[model samples]
Target: MIASTPRVTATHPSLPAVFLLGICALLNLYSPQPILPALAHWGGVTVGSAGLTISATTLGVALTAPLAGSLSDRLGRKRLIVWAITLMVACTLCCVLSTSFHQLLLWRFLQGLTIPFVFAVTLAYISEESSAGSRALVNSVYVAGTAFGGFLGRFVAGTTLEVVANWRYTFVALAVVELVVLCGTLFLLKKEANFTPSRSLLAGISGAWRHLGDMRLLLSFGVGFLLLFQQVGSFTYASIALLHAPYNLPPPAVGAVFLVFLLPVITTPLAGRINAARGPLFTYLLFSTAGAAGLAITLFGNVWCVLVGMALSCISIFAGQSASTGFISSHCQHDRSSAIGLYLSGYYLGGAAGAIVPARLYAHFGWPGCVVLLVALAAVSCVFACIAWRK
Candidate 1:
């Protein structure tokens, strides 16, 4: 048998690092999903309050990711990663230990602080270390893996909660997964300790400011926000709408919706190729417009509409997300981590912002309002795509 050598592009540390990032992502998002019904019952909360678990994490990510990313850029990606993981461990433990709604909210908010390091610095590291030819390929792997990890996290949360009577076990299981990933990360990731740590918080803050002021970065930020806004706003409320009235899907059926939503992410590598060749604008529109159309089907109030919406939004979210990260990496000349921080900060921020809006819309106009909001945002996103395409 002839022996073949491994391709260099196939060998970057990002492959493993992304797996680690996936664990962190799983730790970050998995809890609220399966536990939402329990949380509502436990806390006597409205649908909106039940949803704040998602919003709190997004808010935490939005507000603190820049700081975490800037710190990593200053200190070293590995060091910051270790710190973020440590804090994440503490937060995850707290999640398992918490006794009250307020307590879970507080811990989840703190947990959000860790996402930027995994999201931004990981991207920065991949951008820094990967060869030009394989940068996008590595990105696709990392992003797609992270997406899969999210599914795994949801699986852990859903199954553990179902199998074990205690919700604490769900959080405990997430913490255990994180611990394993941490150990793997320590071994598999290339140590960037030789890199100079950014010492000044003020400098990081200033660098973020400077990056934000750049029109390119701002445009990138807008793209990031719109991508997530349309995604979260539509999906969150659509699930609620489906659970109401005639469709009346079981909770498990609702959960299965997310399962199917993840299906298109298998094409993340292709989306990366599309981004690299046609540019982010074309790819963003292609995905976002499809998502918008799918969301529009909600006007008809049919299960098929929900399914179509899920398909479009998932494809748009996955494709737009990877493309936005690539665009931010290419456009910013300054602290790459800092720029990525800002990008993801906006990304999560959109989740936070959209969470509040759709609830109010649904209150007034029912399903129609949610559709109007998504369609409007899609239209605006189209404008951004057009501008970016011209560049």
Candidate 2:
């Protein structure tokens, strides 16, 4: 009988700890989403301007992800992950004290810069620690935590916004929740048994750039960018659309829409199982179709259709991401961590663009216009996925 790898056995504690890390990272990053309309009201900004809260944070993430990935290689993934959560907890608390939108944006951008410490490392950690047999499932578990975090952050903020009278207090409450998650992570985060810190920053950057030359990996990065752009842009603009005009959803009601995220908690693991059975290429194509179909359905104005569409899209995002991550991890060798980091840079850059550009589209073109933009991006992602498949 063959023995299980030391890496897999050692990764046991890392699994749930990184799960908590995913939750914490997402909670800090997405807290502004449900409250954009409130920001517009309290900060005397337009909806498009208010959406910058999310854009600024994601832009920071885009800027820092590659650096964080390299540092994770040099500093150890666990160290960076722990430090990021500690600093992010403090930054999130400080966000509540901001007196103006500009101040708030500054804090959010700083908050974003810290996110790569956790996110960039967590993927590398999972890739390094888990056995190939278990990597997809573990990745899916982390993705599930992220899905729940995005939901909880929006839901809690929206629900709290209903009762708190002050928007800042909603963040205060989220900060406290994250603080608990932080302490839990500190207790549970395991040491990296496999990683070797890079010798220097120059070598690390050069190594990461080398992976960018691979066409298959490059297309994967493009797919990551477009998928996230569609996800973030559609959701960010949808918040504003649902809050105004025909729906006029109250803050809590707007938050309730994120309940769609719950579907991924189920679909993500299922996706891993399917990917195991069918191969990631098939899994990617299947879910990409599902996501595009979901976006298309949203073109309908009915609340039921929109809700169902959002649910389908949520399932697609998590499952598709799991497949993509698994595929990337499987494909890379010496440059695995750097490659993931580059993918994340594209992913969050798309997110930053998604947050801002979709809001502008919605402002000019309305909700249908927003759906059109998402559909077009999803189609582009499909094209990229096709190219990746051919290679």
Q: Write the per-residue lDDT of candidate 1 for residues 72-161, one digit (tens) a residue.
A: 666767777777887888898998778888888898888887877777887877766655677666777677766677777788888888
Question: In candidate 1, which residue pairs get closer than 3 Å at backbone N, Cα or C atoms, i.e. clash?
Answer: 74-197, 74-198
How close is each model in CA RMSD to the real structure?
4.5, 3.2
Quote the lDDT for 135 in model 2: 81
Off by over 4 Å in 2: 1-5, 9-11, 37-47, 237-252, 356-373, 389-391
List model 2 lDDT by residue over 246-283, tens digit each. 77888667767878888897788788888877877788
Which regions of candidate 1 are displaced past 4 Å?
Answer: 1-10, 41-50, 192-201, 297-301
Instruction: Please provide the root mean square deviation of candidate 1 (C-alpha atoms, Å).
Output: 4.5
In order, candidate lDDTs are: 0.74, 0.79
- In order of appearance, the predictions have TM-scores of 0.89, 0.89
